[model samples]
Target: MTYRVKDMPACKGCPFYQTGEQGFVPDEINTGAKLAIIAQNPGELEELDGRPLIGRSGQMVIASLGTYGIKREDASWLNVLKCRWQNENILPREENILRGAVDHCTGAYLRQNLARIRPNLYVPMGDLALHWLTGRENIGHWRGSVFIADSGPIRGSKVLPTIHPAAIFRQPAWRSASKSDFSRIARELPKREPVVTYSDVFHLGVSAEEFINTIAALKGPVVLDIETKSTRPKSERKPIEETLAVIGIGWGKDVAANYVCDAALDEVLRAIESADVDWIAGGAFDFTVLTHYGVKFKWERCHDLILLHSRFDIELPHSIEFIASMWTDRAYWKHLTDTDLLLYNALDCAAEWEAWYRLAAFCKARAPLVWKVYMEDRPLIEVQVALHLAGMPTERGRIQAEKRWYEKERETAEKALLAAFGSTQGSATAVPVCATHKRYTGKSPLKARKGEAEVCSTCAAVRRSYIDSQPLNLRSRPQMIRKLRESGIRVPLTREGKTSLAKGVVSKLLKKYNDPRLAQLLNYWSKSTAVSRYFKEAWISPATGRIHSVYSMHSAKHRWSCQKPNMQQTKRPEKVLESLGDIVETAE
Candidate 1:
């Protein structure tokens, strides 16, 4: 039967929103459905349209299910999280602050819903889902495994973990993860008959025959995992497959083309998973997502990244960002703490985990809390601790001695920013790219049209200009994207529309991230000397026409970040910030 969310009695006129004409409460399956997918939350479009998987990420999800036997219209999806992940797109602090409430509702729904659906295969789409499944909030240990925890609905069925579909949308390279995922579905897919036709251009880079051959050649039991987002808050779980990006790329990594915050990270991740010849964070999330993407593996003897370290009496990291940035540059979470190192080569991808484990070992010695958390019960706590440990010792005597090093880093960073200002003394803040000028002129060098992605020259040149204009002082990518979006212009898109990677113009325009530019003017349309160092395009801010850069005081701790100035955030800028004042090059 077709289902629209039934507005639960508690949600009627929730203080957070203005109630509109009431709709059905999100259905807690009383019966009839065989398989249920638990996820994070509904996107704005889904809430407004009264449809699941119809939102930007949902579209890709609904389409992906077609590849298997599932259909949003046919099979039921129960989100572990509910509500519009409001304003996070603009003001993340507000979103982060509001997350506490979101988490409450999610727990209530799952506590009640799991008792309802009781499907044989409890598919938690991402790490969040798995958090509740394994009864542990720590992602390091839970990322790639299936366990019978006395929590959630996994008690009643085989918990099959698959990559979130959002990953494929964000990182096409993650198609490798999807291949095996589909194969898993194909195995369990009811043989009655195919009821749906999923129209997806994405495919496994290698055929199933080749995959099987590769697995045989390797000749050993493989590690496997199922990454699922929790139904309790953390709305990223809404699209089940988006979680796979965590598996492919290091969890929390977003160094791909465009970053929609979810799927965009998934594509680059797929690249990492397929490239892992020896150890790529050595976990099951990778194997499981690969399973869905048409790749297959035997998981009789799987090992966990945390287990390996724990065996060595090591502490686990809070997030992949710590290991990646602190340890492995090619690792996904590297952006959480370090500068952009676009891991464009296969060798870099292979070395990622080496860096990650190396840092994990190093940081274990310097962990701030000096406590131990089991992967079984500490996913969230571990992430927190890892970030804390990954922080560098600030450049100060007393503070370093007192271990108040973060303050020293802040002071140093501030001084650097001031010095950069001095270097640019009176260089009429190169006007932020105006829409008309950008359209007619050229784009950035990072986005310079190459091969078939067929980016626009104007867009490419403008991207280059932004690269040239960045002041020498910035911290990470989060700061960059935040400032760019605040400055009032379109953020670039990865081919996947995930991060503002400035790739395929056709892809971003075709999917989400569609900005209605007024002949290229943002609504606020104010001007600024400096925008967030995150993008090659212009982002809009509150009607002030002024660019605002919001800083998360603790954006980096345990590791490096792909975030710009928040520079290491993800989808590295078209050009490095170090070269900002240089003149633009003519490419078009």
Candidate 2:
């Protein structure tokens, strides 16, 4: 049975009614909304207008929803407390009063309304409503997060908590975060097709001769995929001596073939080479790996799915599994076996072909300019592959010497710090009592006389004198904070009030402050971080006597990324280039 507010009588003795104000019932209460929005309470304007949300807060909601192609009428609006009490003193403050009202309203009205509407999603806004709905205290922790409502009439429905529009109006800082949350909701709400499971394509596995014949018969573009033993380059401790495992090829939807990449390798390579256009998910990685295995092909006609999809939606995940989930209805293969692996690879090729057609159509219809840019950037994928194949040479002696120098410099800095602050009580390291540390002792070091309290050795005045100081430890958060404080800069924080020390944040901070010490520290930190992260003993290729990193063109920005001794992020670019001059000449 459908329920409406007119069928039930209003409470008479409630504070909202006693205040000589009329009770409000939303006009579209029984409109059967698929999405429900639960708010804290009604404002004075809402009470007068006889609607749940018609105030400034409602306008914000309307505007945010409009950005994502949703109208205000698309969702049902309800409040945690049904009654409107403008006076703060008359509002329900005691737990018993609030709980009683919630119990009465939920049992009498909310349950029946929910049963009639059966909303797929519930969005709870503000502290009171969000907490009462989810039983969580910290609204900040729950905001912008999706959770399953376990109890009440909204059980089994997705609950996305967000800050109230009223809060955003009061605190402008929350505007961006609220908009981001709304954007995420929009992405998650789009309808999708049912997932496609394993098909009958595996039964079409062909012999080497059959594969050659099948490829020669194909008239259109072919989707290609290769399964390898390891995606990483050959390292000293764990070298990937054998690369290719299975070669999967798809010529249209149902017609697909896979061959064990042992005896039939040459025939498969010949078939791939003969194809007019080869579509690969990560073309750079695959092409470079094939080059290493003594199979070279001109990558002029290669259409990289990674680059194409990145051009369309840079933020979406570009992994084959993720892209398949987004574009196609394919269910990801769960089992891990040789046969399953081959089938997975084959299905990926099929999905790639389908995804390409969809993206091509989308670009042609909506964004012709973007399509042109993608085509122009297509040849650069081959250039990236070439760079990866030409492994960078390293001077082991110079690397060792630089490492030693940094170690000595760090030790000297630590000794100086110890002399400035004195050793910590019963501890090996010296810790200064700065402004932040003084909070623990309830003292202000800045208010204290000179030399009375332990002053920060890296204060603004002192740091300016040592403007060319290099960072000894790049990974140390405390050290980075000290450096920022000494340079009279505020640390960047996220919306949730946590420190944001990302590279972009640091880069902006350096540009704003323009302090030589901070600039030098950042440069040294970048180089030191690259050296420590990538230039390790296990990363060296024993067979080649040079570091060979696995490169992929499937990055979000269509740029190359190197893994396992990342040569793309060298410590000193000029030094490494000079050392690799002979190798570069040979490669050229």
Candidate 3:
């Protein structure tokens, strides 16, 4: 069925639209089907085909469904906007126009379409569809999470969001994640709506006596988590500063207890140190922060959910929100107000506690060896905390000097680049091999072709002329391909058919062509970036007076990865290292 402009009477006079009829793509509905799929709008092919979900994106969704035993005809398909939002060139329209179109269409069509179909389950593809359903964005965080609405056109329907198949073209990594979401949707279709029964037994703002009494009486394993005051302005002076604000503890399946970190602190610590196993999500962070503040507890009594979950399902996110969404019916609370910090913290503990048990039982039943491996590796959490405390000692003066040196190098590089490329203030006299004659920005150096004596002119435009008759952005893949081809070098294309200028591709090009200009271009591009990284990294932690890098044993290969200034990839300055104390190596 073709939807015409006449059908959407309200959209006829909208200023946002430039084209007519070619934009409208009608929905393909399987009436009374249990499932429905929604995308933001029609792509070029989708609009031309005059049907939703017939393009590449639809094909990917269908292919994914095939792996899960779901047929293409099993679900209805629709889009938020019946019309295409892009202009004649296929570029997105102005932001205001885009927003206006979405507002008008969703209000005039999407809601009504959803209400008309009224499927039991809805799979909202990508961020726009997600925002329409839940008023939230960032598909990365929300994907694979089940959201049940109680009030919109989608009310009473369970919506599972997944990244759009088109996202794989730009972010190849999300390909696996997109497939995982479809798997989840398939698994959820047959099951009843996940009923989240968060323990209503929340004890907030209890008295000191009550806090101690609760901690003392706790039996069996408990989930522990803490809320800290972010030392923001003060953080500039003290990078690793964190003050304990609230402690959330969960013992019973339906109970959560939170205490203000006040007068009864010592009693709470001693009690926790002596209690049964404490399940914690991201225990390395919590433990390190507590130890930084001089609070000590038994590491043997703690189980890190991050490590355990990664052992079996490393591909999936192990965040409390992601975990809760998978195992429990806990609503995504990260977006909710944090004014009630204790309540939020308590709920987190509750979710962590619930997810921990669910994940453990799953590992035990399906992958007993994984469960055993986690138990064996659990002791390493203690060693990691100790290493965090034993930070690398640095000579303060030498560290300051090192920073100054990088700053000086950046200044010198900038001056040299400015001298090499004429300021972006003039017209090019001639075009270079790159084909486009464009204005030159004195920001970076453009390497001269072979045998062209490295010209050191105040105006880099002399060399820029040889590159393009029209001004060209060297950073652009198309422009680079043209430039390489002009130089008799055949540029390779990515699997997506775009020009491949990836590091590996460029490296291969350099070896095959052995062009000195290519080598100079690579070095010039990386030089400033390498110098700039000195400021971005977490160089030193004031609390430890040393470099305390975070090491993790969670990867596809199970190889150890270090972050927060990845020490594995970095090398300390010789002078700085000479001034440092002996390394405190932890036993693997």
Candidate 4:
């Protein structure tokens, strides 16, 4: 079954044939091998050697197999495009030409090869090779999961698409993810599609009594989730309750019941509260919103999958979709939110239930102490949920007064700076000198280390003058950098020589420089930024005139993150206390 150039007349008409490159790299077909590794196209070395997967990337793939005790000779190797698509200059051809080449070559060689050397496992590296094998793109979403293809050259084979080794070379963070995929491949789990049996009991004429009874009958650990019309309650004089669109409750692995919110609201709440142990994905919103509907639960009985996931990998995303991708065999269905609401919610409950056990087991086995700490801190979700709903009472009049005062201060600083140095009306190029007396180049390293380049004083003043003449806002990175430079403040650069203006950098610069203009600029920037941010975060409830900000315990390690009105970043706590003096009468 060796594919020779003379045996392939179809390749002569391929888009890559015009490049006059070396002959097609023949597939290293190992008949009866359980695994087949497919790559996008032949690299220069692969093409010259007239063999598929002979380059560095191919070796990395082979080494991953070796980690699982699978030798190189045990798996067949292939390339979607047999010949190299790039020319001698290493420049890829036009988009249409590349697509045409991939289409032509995959059909000509890959399919026939698969038929002869049928593999139980198919590993497609990169998107092009993945699309050829499974007719799917975006390897990021498809990778690390075994996909059972319905129809393709490698149909019915367990296809595991992973990040290309070349991609891992560019982004080293992907290496860990690639290793996870390799580990899954080594396990060689059976190919079985994930299934969830969902019943719309409310719409199907099932009584509310039956729904509650079903939930009560289930063994401990019920997963609860709710879809709502609005994330928060609409504050009004009469206390507007949060509207629930659908309530999803699932027990065990396969059964999930989705009930539309109507007369069954009380029953839905009862079913949720009756469960001895409940599993939820970020239950902060679900529990908080339920409180508005007069539903309360024993917080100790609840488990948040998001918090459980953080124990395993704190930095990785802890969303239900991300967790499910790792633990459950379910396909990606979050996109179905637009088309089918009930089914999407049902799928979410099923994913939550399934991912919870796997995540719990993984944490218990690998990091028992971490799991213990997570369990101890798990009850803190209740505290956070309560704090969010309780909210901070603030005077609308005081907020407006502070905002106006900051705006006036910003105007005063802007005027002083402009008056001292005349507005830059004409073009003036900045001969920006680095802080260490080095020349500024686009390729300069961002770090302000011993040899790294940074913004200079002269360039900073000149840039400030130009920005002062125009509208002022820190909306864009370039504008913010221009402002920072003009103020005679040293702005840090990233490795790619791009502006790195994080809050920490700004704070450090403010303390490092004592120049009057730098002080003025800081005053202007701080006031302007605070005023804008305050207004944006100021979503005060009309009924209580309080900010019900969302809070999270898992976003940061051993710390909480607040959003909406971020109370943590409040600059003047003394001022806030003084404002609340009237509410709390002073005792003599």
Candidate 5:
């Protein structure tokens, strides 16, 4: 029997409907609807029109949906509170009113409608709607992120929380983020199949015999994945702290098994070594962890999915979760038990395997040359992994001393500037005597009118009007220019006739002037920037005593990107360089 809104007995005698206030906005249940959208409440405009979304907010929703080829007439649209309040801000001001409305409306109306429609996907719009449905408060944390709503009107449905269109209009800056969220929804809407779970393919707490039998029956060219405590690789601050939780192996598409890392370590290693081709995502981290755990295998036979994916689209995230979202049809990974980490690993391996083949075919068709180059560079990828494992040497003491030296130099420069300019702490009425005017006056009355009477030789406004005007940091630029002018050297100008403060221009000025103060300021600026970016304590691993930076081999025109104390840009200090000698080589 098909349930209809007209058949619902709760519609009659309802306080909202009885007011003759346009009654309840009945659900527009589209027969083709694979997804349902839940909004906070209908506005006055929607109530007047007797529809779920009819106002500006509704139009925005329709337009956003249209981007994904989803017609407004082809989806179920409902509100948490079925009726709109007469007062526009009544819902937000009176929390109890909304609670009472949801409590009364959902039990009688929403749940019944959901049961009838039974959408595979549920998208809750705005914080209020999301809170009513998911019991979560912060929309910012959950926006565009996928989750399973287990205890609500939309239970057993894949829930994707997104910012409301009204919110986007209120905060214009959120438009880009909202669009991204809509794009994710678009990607997920077409996939309505039940996700293939780990329990379906792998058995946990199995004996060594069971594990061996599971592996032995599997075919060659298997995709492998490992579950660990943390994503960060073994470093000094945190020695290989991540214990192997689960090791998952996928044979072909459907066949897969998960071996408990602690219990079946030996069996897992045996299976990996026996496989003709072992496909892994982030091979360097996984292989290093496995080797650290004393599981020996042939590294030459391993195929890194991350490196391969980078070859095709270097900017795309190569994480297994992201890859699963791209390649798989189901959203099963969103929900899992605490002990199901092994299952998660198994599913990740399956996703990686699927992505590997799809990307291979995609590249071969669209970019055959790129595909060939990637294939030829497979061995080089392995070499890169080895290089990553061998971390760079860092002298903590020398780096700290360099950082201190830069800070002191900057402090000295700042103090000298304060002395020359007579600090901002000086009285507003006291103006410095202009050398041209030879009196404590140049434009005192004009400056006093503007409430900037504390004029100085290095004042940006004064410099711009009466002397050299450059679009550099006013406080430092004027001082640099004054030093150059005092040294009988003309400051270099750009083609636009403005004072040029570019690196090359500044370097030339410094060389010609050879002023100690100018050199000190430049050194201070460079060193301060370096310390903040590269020598932070977070970059050094307390466990390894060396900087273990992760390298992205394809960023910035296919050049390597070094992070975690970016070794690529780490300026060699004399003390450190003298200690390490010629062996201190930067990354290639």
Candidate 6:
């Protein structure tokens, strides 16, 4: 029989199931049951039949219990919500749910069940169920530790407030960890008769935040830097007979050079190219120059310093002289000395590599792993890492969106350049001659190709002006013009841009051949960087079939750095087979 809150009715026609055996009415309870599981509410089936968590929730609990060395038959179960709130049976007012939680009689029923069962351990599955069982207002705060019941048969016992198995079902990754949580419950069962407190079992609980914090702190293994001749006046460029030094060095995962320098220079070159460790200096300019001189040294890894300065935090000096002084720790102002320029440049290049290493380490240790990139040139790993870490700490979905945005931005920049300069190379109608010569000697095109002398006038003026604008790139005009005439714009390559065009092939940046975006950007070198020379071919990676650029995070700002091979340029696409394979490449 059922009773009202204000009035009560005795059990009439209903036979006393266990009352006679226990020698008391509903309030009295048995004292043999050791475990009590209080799930939130009766789902459909249990609500209809008037039982506890015996449906989906009960089945899962039983399964979890089995894993913890406890069987379903070993425990008595109770429901926070005695009745199921089915689709139609749910009350129009939440007042009933609140009453179920707030009413003293409801709690008394719990007390009666525990008193009859005498369960030592009570497990509350969810928030509401916890409230129904323990009438404490702040049920969650009191969850982990054992709270003595103010009114219950098995008062002063320990409680294990764990996530409801239903929630675990929704997030399966939580299963393994949650099972560990359940195991703790069984561990406390031994001291049950003495009523172990909640603090005794619940210590520090684990969460998901710490896992990614560590992954975000990874940095690369190699450092790189470059050197350049940015000191001369813009108009002074002339491609003449001059020797370029080649320094064969292994970078990243160090590999020995294929062709060692001559014996006379071996000692010095080997000292520089030990291959003992990954060594990176700016663009393999020296490498290519050496290659031109019959030194075909195969290289696998290299980090471009310009990219490091641009992408990482490195101090940006207004002049190359100042940069040289600071990074090399040797004054570059005195170039007239017998000292060699390329060798001196190498010193600054090594400093730049270290700067990148330090900055990379700093980023790895303190930053986040996830990011959102709205814009990027190649892949600015440090910036990506920073943005990724910041976003990962907050929202993951936004980081992915940012990555796509950067990809689109890079693509857009490529399309825009191709739109402006088309694929074909431009040409001049005539050539310029030098002012000193009265007649066109074809020596200095900046003067004129033929004519009277304002110093002399037969120059292809507009083309000359365009070429002059590219002062950062020092190309001897007369020599370039002759080469252009022979090679055309699209040959295998011409020392001169005009020569490539003259040969009917457009010689764009070697980096651009494989990557359209890089080629388009290379076309904007005049606007992009302070340089007179362009890259030859890229230092390719065979590991993933995708190119990897080595960059330091502070070269421009002083905290990071990197370098390209040769001088003042990134690695270009390789023209030959296996020229730029992985440093530690394998057949598989």
- Most accurate candidate by lDDT: 4
Worst 10 residues of 5 by lDDT: 442-451
lDDT of the candidates, in the order given? 0.39, 0.60, 0.67, 0.68, 0.61, 0.39
Candidate 2 CA-lDDT value: 0.60
Off by over 4 Å in 2: 1-206, 231-242, 253-255, 313-317, 329-339, 395-527, 550-588
TM per candidate comes to 0.36, 0.54, 0.76, 0.67, 0.58, 0.30
Task: Please write out the lDDT profile of model 6 over residues 12-95, one tens digit for every residue.
Answer: 211211121111112222246577777654555553344555567668777877887787667777654343221122322466
Cα error, candidate 1, residue 581 (Å): 34
Clashing pairs in 2: 196-329
For model 4, what is the error of residue 167's alpha carbon versus the real structure, in angstroms, after optimal superposition? 5.1
Please tell me which model should have the higher TM-score, number 1 or number 5.
Answer: 5
Question: For residue 397, what is the lDDT in candidate 3?
Answer: 56
Error at 538, model 3, angstroms: 3.6
For model 4 the TM-score comes to: 0.67
The digit string of per-residue lDDT tens for model 2 on 299-397 reads: 666777777777776655565544544454443342334557766777767767666666677887899876887888888776766666665675555
Q: Tens digit of lDDT per residue, candidate 3, span 21-114?
A: 4457767788877789998887756755678888888898898898988887788898877775422313243677767777787777677777
**Model 5, backbone clash pairs (residues 3+ apart or across chains), number:** 6
lDDT of 6: 0.39
Q: Highest TM-score among the candidates is held by which one?
A: 3
Give per-residue CA lDDT, model 1, range 343-408, as digits (tens).
222222233434444634564676523224322322332232233223322212221122222233
State candidate 5's TM-score. 0.58
- Report the lDDT tens digits of candidate 4 across residue range 1-588: 223343467787787775343456778899878788888776756755777777898889889888989888888988887765322313253788877877788788777888897666788888888877777868877787776786766677677788789888777757767887888777763333322223322222235676667777777677888777755443321112357777777665556877777776786786676665554655577777776777787887778888777767776666676677788766667767778888888777777887887778777998798799888988997897788678888777666655555667667877876564445432345545545434334222222221225545554554444444555443354665665566566788878876777656666776787556545655666666666675557777876678777777776576888766666644643555565454344220
Give the range of the ten consecutive residues with the poorest summed lDDT in model 2.
442-451
